[model samples]
Target: MNPKISDSIPQEDKDFDKQHIWHPYSSMSKPLPCYHVKSASGVRLYLDSGQSLIDGMSSWWCAIHGYNHQELNDALVKQVNLMSHVMFGGITHDPAIQLCRHLVELTNPKLECVFLCDSGSVSVEVALKQAIQYWDSKRQPEKKKFLSIKRGYHGDTFGAMFVSDPENSMHSIYTSYGPDNIFAEAPQIGFDDEWNEADIEDFKRKIEKHHKIIAAVILEPILQGAGGMRMYNPQYLKRVRELCDKYDVLLVLDEIATGFGRTGKLFAQEHANICPDIMCVGKAITGGYLTLAAVISTRSVANVISGGRTGCFMHGPTFMGNPAACAVSVKNLEILRTGAWKSQVDTIEKILLKKFKPLMESGHRKIRQIRVLGAVGVIEMKNPIDVALYQRRFVELGVWVRPFGKLLYIMPPYIISEDDLNHLVYSLISVATDESLA
Candidate 1:
């Protein structure tokens, strides 16, 4: 079929995209019209149509410092000029080394090593493989099963999807596979209440049932992104840590969306005063300048993975530890260390809560629940249609707010000013309370 051409693009460009492009998480037969962003800076995206939109979701929760920051741009430019790419398997680069040092210092004391990958899904896959190998090298080959929480969203790769909640967006075809290697349950934490003893007992039961063969317990930390923006209790995390310790199972925390000051801290585990055996970090690691993710671990996990004759991790992406991405990450970390970004996030959270509190308490039937953590906030609508409608309406209202199933949420760039944040909250309130959505 000939490609459809938009007037905004040159006919050749349109044809080229239609002939060669297969977009991710999209239906090719009936694709959503693509946006041509001319440029972006601060918290706004300027489209080819000449309309400006607030990046309410931080371009999929990654743009921590916002778009087109001078420092990040300069870093990428400087690195590209010096060394654009290099194989990380044997060669070492300043960007990767410096970023790792910063990350080790920023994360828990136990997490001391970093393994670079291209994206969050790949990081999850790497961590899973590392855990399996850790057990195998330790002579516990039977430990292969992974226990995750129900409705948890990891990423799109096969291994990542295997560990995520099977009922989510990507697992329909794998129904026959069933729940043998993967174990899951409804999240124990909720916005309305904290984790209780019963919740802890149920988690313990699940752990005991699978403890013999379980290799690891994977979670999305305090908030489960792509799972209806569900918020869980940190106490549950503490309990999960204890259970993993007792059962000798590794704990893998997927902080791809929560890391780098997004959760009002350097990492979400800080809330519980606990640390995971392994952590998957992405998104804002490079401040959205380039694709990068890291599988960070303790000396113990590193030792196990490195001890084998295979000589450390069996995984490698061509772009792994790309100098350009790492250089950007080093600069991103420098920006975060300034401490001003976190203070801005805290202020934005306070303003958002104050503006949305009434809508949350209004008992609007279409709104099921409200959850806020650090700079991120979510509103669960009554249905999927409601979610789609709100997303579209919010876009028209000059804000880019994507809805996940029945959940509508915002994770604006930390640099957003109070005025922009207030606008976002009001727009969200309007959509949440609109009777037409019901």
Candidate 2:
């Protein structure tokens, strides 16, 4: 390593980044402060400032086994030496084949076909396209629009953005150009709230009224990320599955954020015990080693698309099945099969609830609600937080937690130690509870 570079990324480097790089939702006129992470291992991010922060966001909820994992690194390196990438046009490889095979077994075994993508958004685009094409194959081209819940976030692509909560999401500005997908009222029933049949009323109404035009009922399953880190009743999803089946609308489950044991189950759809016609899994699929996502579907869906009027699904990425990413993901699945995440997520949830109880019991005025499920813990504020201010505060206190909108949340890696977990939870709660910051 360059001694000068290792000492720090340099003030000029930070200055150059601020001038040139336009980060998510940041403007060039007044950009958000960006930190330089020297390296990462396990649950800590060693920064250029000679300070290490316990990562609470899991590098945006993908590093389930933490960072700089030896197994994942070796897998990626081994595949890279053999061959980094190759055109998937009329070729196949073991890594891609093995990864897809593992994904099918790990998820719903019946979801046999896998469509690899560059990111979560692309996976969603594939899912949306599949639904429309499936209907077209059946000679129902009119069934194009999707039915999605409010406060739901799918992804940032045009197709993904349209299906997300248009009015309340980060992509609202571009909603005018997006497809006019149906948006039912967001689920009013909380994750732990009493499961009233009324909670699913609006969704059911929309499905019934628009069954003819709706191609699919696409949702985030039991847990919704990004738009709002809200969890809903599993029964709501079960009922949604039933309605989709009854109305002849395909069901697409976007398990991007909640897949790979994030929700205590391997997949969030398992909570409802219902298999959708198409499913999107990403984020943690490669254990944060590389960018990869998959749109897995049933044989019926895949066959219909291939034998459709247009022919062969009509879409594919240049890096469709990159060997290195596939090898890393295959290893990631093998490690997950070891079942270590089960206990880690179990303990993390238990400890979060235990530590967060004091805040709930205190009845803090600023706190809107407190929710925990699996490895995710959220403390919703009554008002939106000063993101930049709170972010610096968190760094100063030696933790990395990125809060958005009204949600101050943590989705830490499953392998985080008890001490690191407490440190992160305590540091976050302290900032949340502190009157000076609030």
What's the TM-score of every candidate structure? 0.94, 0.97
Off by over 4 Å in 2: 1-7
- Highest lDDT against the true fold, candidate: 2
Off by over 4 Å in 1: 1-7, 10-20, 175-179, 189-192, 309-311, 386-389
Q: How many clashes in candidate 1?
A: 0
Tens-digit per-residue lDDT, 1-438, candidate 1:
211223477778766666678765555665544556788999998876677788898889889899999999999999999999999877898888999999999899999989999999999999999999988888888998898888788898888888887766567687566445555566554744745767667668888888889999998888888866777777888889999999899999999988888777778888888999999999999898889999999999999878865667788899899999999999999989988887888998898788878877776878777878889888777777544455568867788777656777899999998889988988887877777765
lDDT of 2 by residue, 1-438 (tens): 111212466678777888988898788999877777888999999887678889999988899999999999999999999999998889999999999889888878779999998999999999999999999998999999999999999888888999998888888889779688999987863777778998889999999999999999999978889878888889999999999989999999999999999888889999889999999989999999899999999999999988989878988899999999999999999999999989999999999999999888887888888889999999999999999888888888889999999889999999999999999999888888779975
Give residue 163's error in model 1 in angstroms: 0.5
lDDT of 2: 0.90
